[model samples]
Target: MTRKVPLANYLFTRLRQLGVGAVHGVPGDYTLRALDYLQPAGLRWIGSCNELNAGYAADGYARVKGISALFTTYGVGELSAINAVMGSYAEFSPVVHIVGTAPRNAYTSRAMVHHSLGDGNLRIFADMYAKVTAAQANLIDVKTAPETIDQTLEQCMVQSRPVYIELPSDMVAAQVPEVRLSVPLNVSPPKNTDEAEDHVVSAVLSRIYASKKPYILVDGLVAPDGIVDEVSEFARITGFPTFALTFGGGIIRGDLENFHGVHAGKFGTLDFTSYTDTADLALLFGPLLSDTNTLGWSTVPKKEITISLRRTAIELGPSSHNLHIKSFMQKLITRLDSSRLSARKPTPSLSSPRDLIKNLPEIDPSAAIDQDTFYLRISSFFRAGDIVICANGTPLVGGRDFVLPVGARLINSSIFLSVGHMLPAAQGIALVQCELAESGHTPGRTIFFEGDGSFQASAQELSTIIRYRLDVTIFIINNEGYAYERHIHGMDEEYNDVAPWRYLEAPSFFGAPTNGSYKIELHDVKTWGELDKVIKNAGFQDGKGLKMVNVRMGRDDVSTNFKAALQLAGRQLMADAK
Candidate 1:
């Protein structure tokens, strides 16, 4: 007496079971029928402007809500979204990319479909996706479809990476077993051997006891690996000073006494790297040491002094042990003796981001806003629990200097470095926030800091935001063109120039109403005083509806870190050319 369900029902229901509340995608002929099952499966369908934007939105949703789903038609749609999925893969976002592909007959007969290449092959896209995704499920057989979907989603959750599922149109309505839906997915990491765990624990504890000056370095992977709470507790329990990499800015609680500011390597103010270099024991959690994140790799501590914790392994100096991060953290926290550990005072030279910003020379209120003081001054406008999304380029550099309020999260492309991410991603994040708030969770504002060039890449998604009426505040850093590019190789090159739009008119052009029914406020700022006033306004802070602020700055003005990094890049390019 096995119950039967439509294949689409089983797929979408499994997604819902894994905590996916909404699905993001662009509709196409192949997926038109499959999209209908979303609502029946208790999932909200978000129609984004394009497949790429939909992928970005899904990535953002996954980062916040733990898991997200996206749909796209075969060939063209899937190809367009591959870049975003690759970005998700690079940054460890668990995104289930469900593709409505050509019917089974087309694949079997090798027939050409409208969306596919005129050639007979329909497997090319799925084959391409297999390179970037953790797993692939081509549901050609109805009998194995249920298990295939279950395992695909399980891989996504377990690896915290993207997975591809190619569902042929003909198979959407095919009957499948519903019995498999009752079994929950097992995403927990396999347990480590008792002896291995004990050995690693002993090594770590020995370092803690022997070291005179031990420090902790937090990174972005802590969030994906589900160890932020454990890391926070470990930091509190131990009196060691904690520092976050650029990607790890919001990972650590800013209010902790021993929580130092972001470690910017050589690009940071003098004295920041001194304490890190001199530390005898560095407990590095979830270390994603991209050159940009580590300030050209200048900030990564010496391997001899580092004990790196990863998702499935622990690296102690030159040696490594295969132990689950969660298990190791749990055992280490329980076994750690704070009373026996060394008591080291906070480093005098390493100051908090707030204190650093306060010490900067005050800019004239009437002067044009510059990158140096912009993000730091805007820090005053943030409150606890705010979610700030910083786009790549100037905003990424400046945002790292922001002194995030307690409980705030900074979402940025720290390693992926995608430019047009923050806008549509903000839409997805805001949507998830509203969905969760309905369930008694405290809602937070969705603040997006985007560059003008980056905004244009995915600007069409503004309509989706307006249609949903999400509380999203967008601040476009209008530096006229690609400022980051200008510093690297094209100082005044025509390729770096972006056409200037009447940036403030976005809301009206995107179908926003003039009447006060929906709060759509648009403002532009050039001077520091104007930016200050906009940040202090009641309507801006109310978090009612869509608000856009266009901030105009010079193309040459960039964060000190970015400028220095660009100079190094230019020199390297020159050396290569020679």
Candidate 2:
């Protein structure tokens, strides 16, 4: 008995089938009716303060839960979230962006709308979205709406990037056959070719057997492309010295014997630099060759020595192959002869500067905290099964140095550099964590390393966290201003300074109880002793509800890499002035 369902139900039902537990967005005239179907389709509606925040939340959710959906009204709403969607495209986060559009009659008649620019061009929004998303679908016809919906969603999953779809306001209740609901959408990866797989595996294995010094360089793509388990297994099987780019922090479990931490070019530790730079063969998986990820492109292994595995192709030195990387990894894992692989050299402990700093003498209780000592000390607080997020400032640079336990996920923008993204993203992740816990799964805590400047940008979203009472812990690096920007261009400019707020009062200001079931703990730490005490506190250890820790540092305080970059920039500025 095939039932006729509304187009909105058909779309939301497909999203639910694809494992979308919640949808994040803001309501508008065009999308208000579409919002009504969310609950009926068995999806939770998380209304964000704005469209951009909703998009950021959706991106964060996607990173944790694999796929997420974000709804926005046409024109005004969609444009606001374009940056977030762009970030998703740049980083390969799978997000399905559905836009509630003007009715078909309005589009046919060129009717003027308030949200539009009044040029009678309703297609402009979809056109703009096409540039940022991997696929786009405009649903004006009832006959092909289901096919369009499934196709657009399949693109989002296949490419691990955003896909755009337009749902007209008046077409929400249009009749559509619900037969497709029983059949799951084909979101699987394309079938691997036997010839291509054999060639890629043979080439990679040949290089592995011939090389004297072989290394594995993991990048951020391991998560988006669904190959973390494969990569981990490969690393374990080969036991090769493994390193990561800055964006690849949490993907490789730090506890692994082969894991040697992130490779920061000349900026990395002596052993890290020696092993990576002197490698004869490098297996670079999911390489995102951004300047930030590669330490200004210095850490990128020589092209002749690097075998790159991309999403759709494989590149070995100068030669290239049209083979899927995920497929190549799967075949290589099964075919590789472990007995023939080179024996790994027993390397010394690759403790980061953070690790060494923790061994230093205890500082004065009244002494102010700095980047080097602060990040390492804070690393001790992170336990297993925690999702750590960092803002686009000192926290971004410093938090990457923290050692993550197995099962930890680190979310940081390598190239997007959106400052306020992590704050609202933490909110979305907290919501997802709550859902995972209710299903009898191992629930993880959402931990954020945010700057005061970044926190101010998305401060209103904290209210959403309190309303939902999601388990989130935020450590506000209250460094007084846009510390990252200062290191880049304006070192002492007034424009970089942010407005001062009582950072510790955020929970109460956002409507949390003073002392009740949803009890929010607050801490203001200015020294190492205070931070240590707070981390060891009973309330913080419980990790139940919202916990806020505000640590004050100098405005000029930044990581060593940031300091070096700042010095180079300063010299360049001086030369230009001359």
Candidate 3:
């Protein structure tokens, strides 16, 4: 006789097999019964304060763990979290969105449910999800449920995007065959035809060998596409100059001799821009050329001389080929003849963030901490194995200038540009770090750089972080309002301002223990002297459960690179005014 398990049990077990250790979401009426199967399936249920934060947390967890799961009730709950799911789709984070809905009887009878639109349209929410999710399945039959679940999850993994599943309340306890669980889901993409693969490889190598000044640009999608190692190895073996866009920063090893920092297009130094402009050939990996990622398209390479390698296709100038990036890269690397490639010397004039920091002149300690020197000064605080997250607004802009250590990962909103994403994302990242530490891996601290205005949007999540006692260090740039918005359009507009709060008291207010094995530290710094002392303290350097630092800066002051973009926007607005 074949063994069987409940539908919810089978679903949660598959998620566990996919390496999702925790399910992030809020407890809702429709999902309450299904939640009972999580722990039995070896998964933890993290009850978030709201569905939106839960969605953001799931996205963050997926970034660290490769895949994650989120639970939400029907219409209201799912709709609230839709924006976050859209962000995951835009950025290629794999998230399993399992939504619990009313019983099959309600759908068959066309009954109006509490969460529904009152017009008996039960499918509206699922219809909306179909637009953003890679795949969707309504599990109504036990016999077909297992196969459907596996297929949808496979799509989520292969595509590296969100997928949706509708679990009827009555089906939660329905029995399903356990035999299918014995076979692991296969998520590998289809192999390219040998003839097609060979043509693309030959084309790439021919250009690479013939070019005098060749450069490699790694973009944000490389990580989600699982090609970071391959791309890094290619760049390493070639000994070619390589640079990452803002979204791709820290994915490649930063200590490489030929590794330049982030290329910010028009905002970059003249020497750096001049070097890239003179390249005879350019190779792009997982290129995501959004306006914000490319600094208003200023960093895009000349199309005539560029070759872009995507997950499913390869673009060579005007021609396109159906080829898998991973398979093609493997073949190209094996066929590379290093001796045939042109040799070029490294440009000494291009200065990295570390070089700029080292050459800085001493300043008055009593002087207020300004945006021009803040990110550079804080660069020394980062260490290897740190997972640094920057929220949208000023943090994202200034964080591009960080000189990350080897093994560090920098995460920011490259396309979604959500304002309050990093704080809860830090929570998810820190939870994974703790889980890794318990499993005998060297755990890293979750460092978050947030804007004052953005922090208020999801401040309740801080209490959840304190309850879990995750190791997270938060640096809040208190510029009194949305300084990033101020620079873009309004210099002193009331709409750009945020209400002031007692920022340093957040730890206690969030219920961090006053005395325990885990300690909480809070500091308010206004001047360069105060900031310097806080960073150098032994307690602050040690990765603790909860640490908060409030650094005050001028509202109009922004990073130099960001200031350039803002000035252009200001001029555009002025032109519109006339």
Candidate 4:
């Protein structure tokens, strides 16, 4: 039972105990051993194109599992990951980062390292994380390495924040002392007593009770920790409208009254923003109101009160709790009504699937694409058990606003906001859930709403899917350009206009198509007759192989989305001026 700690083995053990599903990064001289160590023990070692993409992929994984891993080489690798780590920290996802370091012997004696910062040089990247992560450990002593792993993981798990562990390649093989690695010891969340809880509670209830148009702000953490029901009932008891910041809180449940919708902020459905801006009081259940959640501080209602509980966080490590509204809603929410709230049936404007197709333009073979019109068609096809995975650019803007069903997860890289997020994310969720389905553990469908700009970045993993042969569908919104740039910066006579490719042909390139029926089809259904046939074909044939459908979107019809985003931004800015 006395296994001398190989640095990789110890770190791997620590990651698994902390619930890290996968460690993603392109390996370099510094990270080879850690990457090899992580895989054999059941944790996935996913190799992404660049370090930045790996960071985003880890963030995507954390979105579902609530914990993830970022493995990278030293210096540049660690630096690349900081933006992503900061993003997750802001949103409260637990991400474990293992940065490869100089091999113990060579690095120890070297006084001046090339990538080292000033002062004859030391690793400055570890210090950079001090503001964001709950803990950062730079271990030099082999004897104390075991304690290093325990302390760092403890902070990551309990606080639901990120933790960085720096490992010198020198230490990877260094014979270290043995230590016990087990499930984390029990720890209590910071508790509030009667006096502390009562005052905040009374203030919250009084605000919620008195306001005729009161509401609940359900952030990402509320539902994952199993608090959705209590907050859902709170909305019912007070008959308040509810919303989600980055989405989680039952905004899409459809059972609550006047469910105004999730706080899409600058990136959400247009109507929802108006409701959030005007609400008299906001009982923000457990949201951090991170930068991504706010869309670069694009908008916030000044009149409303914002409250967050112990579990529902308002402040992060070293961050301030900024709010004008009630900060005491969490204590009061537990005691509210639990009965099923009055329901509002969604009257779909695109009433029927036929109606949706009728409104949608036919997918063109030669014509360029855009994210807007494709979202219209894709939204129309969504089913009960299907979850949508949106990429950062056109795919997210094109699709995240679409109404999803209850129990249908909407996975996106909203926090990290990086490209290539959709492919790896869809791969991770699809692989996990497919395994679950095979074992009869769960039943659901996952569809990745990805774009060409993203897909091309990480499309090398296409073989992994066919080799595993998972049940999932990837809807490639092929505009052929970086579509987000197209939206923000117009394509008027600019090189933003990219050449088109036969994307459906990609599966063949991977060489491991599903059942050898790897399909490559361009979707072009101008009318219901063509569209229905296309959908029916995809529905029956998705699991048969790697199905790539080239959805020719509304590239030229950017007016609607352009206006949708800018108009909202403009009106809101004017309101803020007021």
Candidate 5:
């Protein structure tokens, strides 16, 4: 142990122990000291062009690494990153946010504070995120720093959401507090064999058994929680068709007989919607059911047995209920007496609507797969612990709905919901994975799927990818426009149109070393025949270089089969209006 360690060192060490191998962000006033210390502590400091992108980079890293961190200066930094932090909240990807501020005493004085952004500048990020974070602090109460940090990590790692911990500039040099790093990371989900686990399991199981139409739905609990296999076991035990309401993927695989598909918003599957809500017993495991994913709230089962692995304190009412997700899953698996499971309605053949859209003069392959199938296919690409970096626009369709392979992540502006988050997020995630790879830890990959509109936002990250020499496979869905915007505004031209860029030239323009930098490959497909080659390419798994595939489709076509979706939403809104 080195002597005279700074307060920042303690925070960094704490994070290092929690499996955070990298930190993402552009160093600012508050975070400069810690950023410097990070280099010496064997941490990779990844940079993005802006703080928002920095936060997004960190969020993506968190998705794959199980836990991730970002450091920035005060106010401006914190505010910019808020969207990404919230995105992580929406996806339930656990990430640690460290923002630098002045010493608590510095703000205590009444001297108009020369250093802040216009108006109230004292507490800064603390107030903005106190409600959403697991814990937060600065250096003033140096003694409590350790406790605060520990609790914050515990909360973030266990709950699998974004948490904020503000560190003052002076705190970076403060003395270390009393906290042992070798506490043996016991992150096992809530353990209970008897009343706790068994009771909850029996309740859910009995309900499912009684109701002719019961379904299993899960969310963020799968990743950052190390319980995907266990959840799969539980699903196998009960023969109820499963579908997730809040999607960060991995609740169920399309190949799996149990998984029906994720249904949400204007992009949800009408078939799945018709089958699931009609049930009497609806099990919501490790899910929030956020507003964006209302999933026809007016139509959801009147009764729901909600299960959360770390729902110690939640706000709920009479119509809904809760359960400790881990214990509930464990007990459910234990109680099953053989009798493997089966799907409710033989998961009908997955016929794509690509034909209808393709028949039109122009339809992008990237937008070819409906939200559900797109998510299903993307989920097929990775497993637990692999990072799935999502770009804005079309890519998030896969992020929000894809059934992740437990521990697989959904990285973007978690809640911030910004569009250009993908590449920057992947940069941070890859840097960490590269470090971990060097340390001989787990062999994992960082994959990013960029949208035409969103890719342009952080296209510079291709250079960053080559600068650090990371083996990140980026799949740029060259749809050449902002597809989602069209749906939102009644499919108008202006909302969906954008200046088309040579998607494959990004790496070449950035001077990726001839041999060192991965080659940026382009694929402009006009027909399904051409798309097959893009999807079947062996290069995706190797992840050797910056391979950019320009997928071209018919532009005159409006293949998005949102008719049923719009109809349902209209009906539901009308119902709620009454």
Candidate 6:
């Protein structure tokens, strides 16, 4: 006899199979019944404070665990999470967005639902999702539900982007063939033709062998494209000078002698840019060249001299070849003849962010912590395996300069540049780390650098973090408001200011245990000495549940790289005003 399971159970089971140990979302009337199936499917339910934060958390989880699921009710709930889903789409995070919609009869009768427009249009939300998600599935029939769910999830996994599944409330308990779960969904990319693979490999090798000065540029998409290991190996095998862009920071091992720090293009040091500009060939891996990621297009390598390996295609100079990036890279690595490849000596004189900090004048312990010196100084605090989350504004800009410890993963909004994303994202990332630790895997603490204004946007997620007792350390830069915005156009405008709060009281307010085994620690640091004390304290360094640090800086302070960019933006704004 063929086994049968509830439709919701089948869906949850599929997610669990794809490495989603927990589902993140707000429980609504439509999804409440389906939530009961989570435990049965061997999954945990993370009840987020709101749909947006849930979506953001799901995105974060996907970044760490490869794929994640988000459950939301119809119209209103899905709409609230659309922004985060879109960010996932743009940045290549695999998220399965399961939306619980009205019953089949309600859709047939065109019933005006409370969460929908009164005009009886219930399909509008799903239609909106179709634009942002890689694929969409509307499950109205139990007979086809199993296949639909598998195919939609496969799309999410293969494309590394969010996908939508509209599960009707009435169909939550509808019987579906459970036997289908025995056959794993095929999420792997189709194999490339031998001819095409050979041609691309030959073309890439020809350039590699001919060039005297070749460089490797690793971008953020390498991780999502599932080629980080291959790319890293290629860089290691070929003793070429390697550099990562802002978005690509921390993806590659930073400890390599050949690994120069992030290439900031026009904003970069003259010595580094001069060397990179003279390179005859560049092997660009997983290139995502959004303006912000590329420093307003300044950091983009010359296409004429670059070979770009993307998710689905390989760009050789002016032409693109249809090839699987992972397979292509694997084949290319196997065929590489190191004897023919040109080897360059490592340039040790180039100044990295670490070098900049070393060259700084002796610190005055009583001096207020400023943006220019903070990131460079704090770079020493990071350790291997740490998953660092930086917020959209100052953190993102300053964090690019971090000389991360080997194995540290930096999660920043590269293209979306969304505010309030990192805090909730920290909760999700930390949750995964906690799970890994429980499984006997060595996982580092989830460290987050957040701005006060960004923190206010999704602050309630802190309660979710505390409730789960996830291990996370948060450094809140208390600069009063949006310091990045202040640098752009408004220096002292009231509109840019955010209301002040007692940030150190967040853990207590969020319901973290005060005297129990899993306790929360808080620190307030305004000066360099205070920050050093907090960073060195044993309780703060090795705390269990949650630790919060409030580092206060000037409202107008901005990183050197960002200050130049923002000043140009301000000048442009002024010209437009004139």
lDDT scores in order? 0.87, 0.85, 0.88, 0.60, 0.62, 0.88
Show where candidate 2 strays beyond 4 Å: 269-271, 349-364, 569-578
Cα deviation of 130 in candidate 4 (Å)?
A: 4.3
Per-residue CA lDDT of model 4 for 1-578, tens digit only, reads 56685777877876776566567777878878767777656677777656766666576667666678888877777787777677777667678888887765645465665556634445566678788888988767788887877878877766778888888876776676554665453433445456755655555555545664545666656633445556665656555555655545323464343454545554553445555566566565555455545555543445335544446343322333332122234555564433422222232321222334456666664444444454555565666666568777666554534655566667654455656656766665665565456568655666777767777767766655654565567777665576556544454646566557666666667665445454434453334355456666655444433555666555544325344564455466668879
Candidate 4 Cα RMSD (Å): 5.8
Candidates 2 and 6, the one with greater lDDT: 6
Residue runs of model 6 more than 4 Å from their true location after superposition:
269-271, 576-578
In terms of lDDT, the best-performing candidate is 3
Worst window of 10 by summed lDDT in candidate 1: 265-274
Model 1, 1-578: lDDT tens digits are: 88899999999999999899999999998899899899999999999999999999999999999999999998889999999999999999999999998888898898977877889988888889999999999999988889889888989998999999988899999999899889898887778888999888988999889999889999889989889999998998886889888788788887788887788876764336777888898999988899889877887889999999989889988888888888889999999988888755656666777687778777678999988778888888788878998988888888877878888899987688887887889999999888968889888888999999999888999999998888898889999899988888889899998998887787788888777778988888999989888889887897779888899999888977668878888888889999
Tell me the TM-score of model 4: 0.78
Per-residue lDDT for 41-102 in model 3, tens only?
A: 99998888899999999999999999999999999999989999999999999999999999
Per residue, candidate 2 scores C-alpha lDDT tens digits across 1-578 of 66899999999999999889999999989999999999999999998989999999999999888899999998899999999999989999999999999889988888898798898887887888889999999899999989999889998999999999899998999999999899998888886789878977888899898888888899998888788989999998888888888788789877787776778766553237766677799999888989778767888899999999888878988888877677778899999898887756545644454456457677677788888767666777878888999888778778657778778888888888787898888988888899988889988778888999999998988988898888889999988898877876778899999999998877787899766879688888888878888888877876789889898888888876557765665676779899
Give candidate 2's error at residue 42 in angstroms.
Answer: 0.3
Return model 6's CA RMSD, one decimal: 1.5
Assess the local accuracy of residue 113 in candidate 2 as a C-alpha lDDT between 0 and 100: 80
lDDT (10s digit) by residue, model 6, range 303-391: 89999989998988779898888888899999999999766566655656666767878778999999887887888788888898899
lDDT of 3: 0.88
